[model samples]
Target: MYDSGKIIAGLIVFVLLVTFPFISNMGKASAKPKPSIDTPVINEMAVKKCVEPKEFMRAEHMQLLNNWRDSVVRNGDRIYVNTAGQSYNMSLQNTCMNCHSNKKKFCDECHNYMAVNPYCWSCHIQPKEQPNEQPKENML
Candidate 1:
């Protein structure tokens, strides 16, 4: 009778273990809505293809800085419209602040969300600014 009870208890434990995953609602709150598989699909040729413009760099990404300067100072606008034919307008102010502000709040939130490892703080300084002293004075 003791052996039978042991076998019944073992069977109950095995059943609970196998069904635990299905019964658990641990992930239900955060689960993303499933996309409809029956939705009509459009062919690739039917959709307009937009290629991101090649990022310009003169020396070590200097061109990006120049572009930023031109967009901010010369154009007097933060938006850089790439008439070179693209679907989206690249905004310097929006993109920069989106990642740099509050370090952990906005930037880290999305970085952690997408599992991307950023290397900006390692080599370059944040809030890029002009040198306070003149180059000639530094040489003296």
Candidate 2:
């Protein structure tokens, strides 16, 4: 009972400090970015479809890309058969970039929103300014 007043004041200060951030940021969060798929290749497709389904691609694209890299580089497998039984060339540059040429709009949008720094550009050349003369489909 000796330091009851001091203890109460300290507890109140600690609670305020802990809750300050949440209170300040209430209703101020930016909306998540929706990646665009408006490139020429995508637009020209009579039936616009990705290698995998949209739901699967959204959640597991990174894992799939990693698997592709391992398969292509390590195991020397260059083909990917999706869940739908369609075959595709497993490539980030030729296959993916061919369709998703608008890298800033398509790739960077969601990546930046998620605060991730993918090392895709460290070794591979960025295809922003490079023109693909004839954008060919990777799927069979």
Candidate 3:
């Protein structure tokens, strides 16, 4: 019992030190980012829809992509039919990126926010993004 007070003080200090990060960052989390889908192809579409429903894609896109990779590589299958019975090509670049041209806005925003480093680009090539050119007004 001679060192009981000192032991308690050291334990409190250690607990505070361990919990400093949680205490310091309380209620300071950033808002979830909303990815932009303002590509010309999507703009031209009458109905703005993806290969699957928005919620389905948001939750199961990784699994869907993995299945697509396996289907294409292993079985040489290139067609994907959605739940709505609509057929789509399984090419990520030609199909997905064809509409989602703004990678920084569409893909990077969510990926960065989620702190994920997806290895899709290792085997697949990332589509080249065209620079967003603001329309210059003609000076009279």
RMSD to truth, every model = 17.1, 7.3, 8.1
Query: Model 2 off-target regions past 4 Å?
Result: 1-13, 23-29, 129-140
lDDT per residue as tens, model 3, 1-140: 67999999999999999999999989997688889999999999999999999999999988999999999999999999999999999988898889998877898789878778788877776666754643132111
In Å, residue 91's CA in model 1 sits off its true spot by 12
How far residue 13's Cα lies from its native spot in candidate 2, in Å, is 5.9
Q: Model 2 shows how many backbone clashes?
A: 0
Alpha-carbon lDDT of model 2: 0.86
Model 1 clashing residue pairs (backbone): none
Clashes of each: 0, 0, 0
Q: Write the per-residue lDDT of candidate 2 for residues 3-106, one digit (tens) a residue.
A: 98999999999998999998798999678798889888999999999998899999999999999999999999999999999999999999999999988778
lDDT of 1 by residue, 57-94 (tens): 21223355456666767777665544464433344334
Look at candidate 3 and give me any clashing residue pairs: none
TM-score attained by model 2: 0.77
Q: Which candidate tops TM-score? A: 3
What is the Cα-based lDDT of residue 15 in candidate 1? 94
Estimate every model's Cα lDDT from 0 to 1.
Answer: 0.45, 0.86, 0.86
Question: Ten residues in a row with the worst lDDT in model 2?
Answer: 131-140
